[model samples]
Target: MTFEQHISGNIEYLERPGSIGGPVLVMLHGIGSNAASFTPLLDHLPRDWRVIAWNAPGYGGSIPLDAEWPLALDYAAALKDFLDRLELKRVLLAGHSLGCLIGAAYAAAHRERVVRLLLSSPALGHGVPCGGALSAAAQARIDDLQTLGPDGFAALRAPRLVFEPESNPEIVRYVRDGMARVSLPGYPKAARMLASGRLIDDAERLQVPTDVIVGAHDVVTPPDSARRAHAALRHPWRGAFTLVPGAGHALYQQAPVAFAAALAALAETVG
Candidate 1:
């Protein structure tokens, strides 16, 4: 499959075109990742599926939001506009970490556009009491980036994101490279958005099918957190919660086959 850049309106994305009648899968990357982060995972998906992975606002040369610190809804609005520009009326939406926050918000706002929602290494941002801790952590991330700079921040943060960085040099390099591409001004704003996210509330309000997948060893948004997010799901729209073995926060990179398997299952079952 070939991946290339496409710009419609003001948004830029990396897209792998699919055969006619195939399902459309739109991927949203995590905070420290770009559209390229989904390459390995995309390789494991069905060849016929149309896959489009977006470099979220400010990442990978994409446009940044005008606001100093935009909310999750702001990011979701940009996503909606991107879809509209492309004329993608319906798609299977998947997201990782911070992307999950945006995906959930988008699904809540535009229920008809998303057929199914898949959240990988899901990061649920509850507001207020729990939000306080998340906000502080997000600020710390911004502070660390400011102090360390891109390369330095990637060096220190990349290894910890995976389960076994010392033994997995290749994955370490990949993660580090992705992190190094993070947009400084954009990242701080994203962190602030994450700090104020309301994913659980959105999940409760969702009317379409949704699934949550997480790596068993993920320290950042561990299995417990994924479970809690699933538990918070309200009646009719609630879906499955899966834990993939031998992976961590960067599960899509470390165990892409299993990650894709979970995603494929969701696609087949939901379709």
Candidate 2:
């Protein structure tokens, strides 16, 4: 099934409508990615379910937040606005990488609105306080973007996001292309959010069923980090942590079938 891209209010999203009154799945991408990052995973998803992936604030045609360094809650507020604009009361929220931080904040703040939560290759932010000095890792990302530009930065970093670029050239190229499209304001803002975010704090407050998935070979956010995030979950889904072997940070793209299976498993549990 093909996804139709559209702008709802200030948010741009890709949607594939399924059966009327069918289950809804909403996806949030990582800092370097936009909604298109979820396209591959969406194709493998159930045809009877509705899926929507949003370009977080500052990406695509979505408006940037007013704050120079927006917090996870700020992004959560933007997410709330996007969902409200779509008239969606409840949804199964799936977040990847940096998106996990935002999703955790949203789910914790509005637990009633999220039916289930799935976090992939979760990035546990550096926990730097707002207005404080950024971590060396976070500063390096910002420095790379500024020094290398989008294309150069993407070329240099995208390869590391996947486990084996030689084996998954197409997926690597896809990820590289997505990263290359990340522009200013949004990219920098997301970096700052990462510097300040501590996903575990929000994860600990979550009352909804949650699951964590990570690439065993992921270098960006390794399985150990994913396990830590899973351990912090207040209500872990089936008390499980999924490890996608031979995949990396971009697990959804590198292993879409496994990612889809995870979503299918979540649906089964809820139904």
Candidate 3:
């Protein structure tokens, strides 16, 4: 399933169209990731299920947001604009790591726009209030980017995204390639959003059906964090927290079969 790249207004996304009137799935990648990062999961997904993965503002060719320190709501608004331009009335929203924050905001605020929500290795942001200084962790992301540059930053951090880098060289390289594309303004803005995001709060407010999954071996957003987020969901899809085995932070890439099966199960059984 080859994904075709398209630009709708200021947003850039990769799409793999399915049968007419089929279910639509919108994928949002993490801070270090781009739409291309979802490629590994595509082959495992059903060809008839339309999948669209966006390169959040600043990544890929998309323009950066105006606010230097944007919030999850700002990203949600961008997402709304992108969906509006596509004339999509509703969709299945899937978020990974940092993307969970943005997706949670959107799904909570625009409940009518999302039919279901799927989260992977959900990142619990720093939850700093607006106008507050960036947390040490958030600041480190920016500092590392400045100190290492894109390629170096990717090389240094990409392996950490996987459980065992030595065993998963291909996945490591893929993540590295994606992270190496991160540029200024966008990366910093996203960093600030991470500092401000409170994914659990948004999850608690969601009226839409939601499911959360994490890699059993994930160190970034470990199973415990994912469980906490799942506990916060008001309408968990199956009232369960899924942990994909033999996977890590990059579970979608590391355990594509399990990831795809979980996604398909959600679509098939969850209405």
The local lDDT score (0 to 100) that residue 34 gets in candidate 2 is: 91
Q: What is candidate 3's CA lDDT for residue 66? A: 95
Judged by lDDT, which candidate is best? 2
Better of 1 and 3 by TM-score: 3
Worst 10 residues of 2 by lDDT: 232-241
Q: Which residues of candidate 2, in runs, are more than 4 Å off? A: 235-238
| lDDT tens digits by residue: candidate 1, 124-226 | 8636342344566887889889999999889999988898788888998999999998866889878878878777788788877888899898999989988
Model 2 residue 217 lDDT score? 96
TM-score-best of 1 and 2: 2
Return the TM-score for candidate 2, rounded to 2 decimals.
0.97
Q: Model 2, 1-271: lDDT tens per residue?
A: 6689999988889999989978899999999999988888767888999999999999999999989989999999999998999999989999999999999999999988998889889999999999999999989999999999999999999999999898889989999999999998889999999999999888888888889999999999989999989998763442468999989999999999999988876675463
lDDT of 2: 0.90
Order the candidate numbers by lDDT, best to worst: 2, 3, 1
CA-only RMSD, every prediction: 2.1, 1.2, 1.3
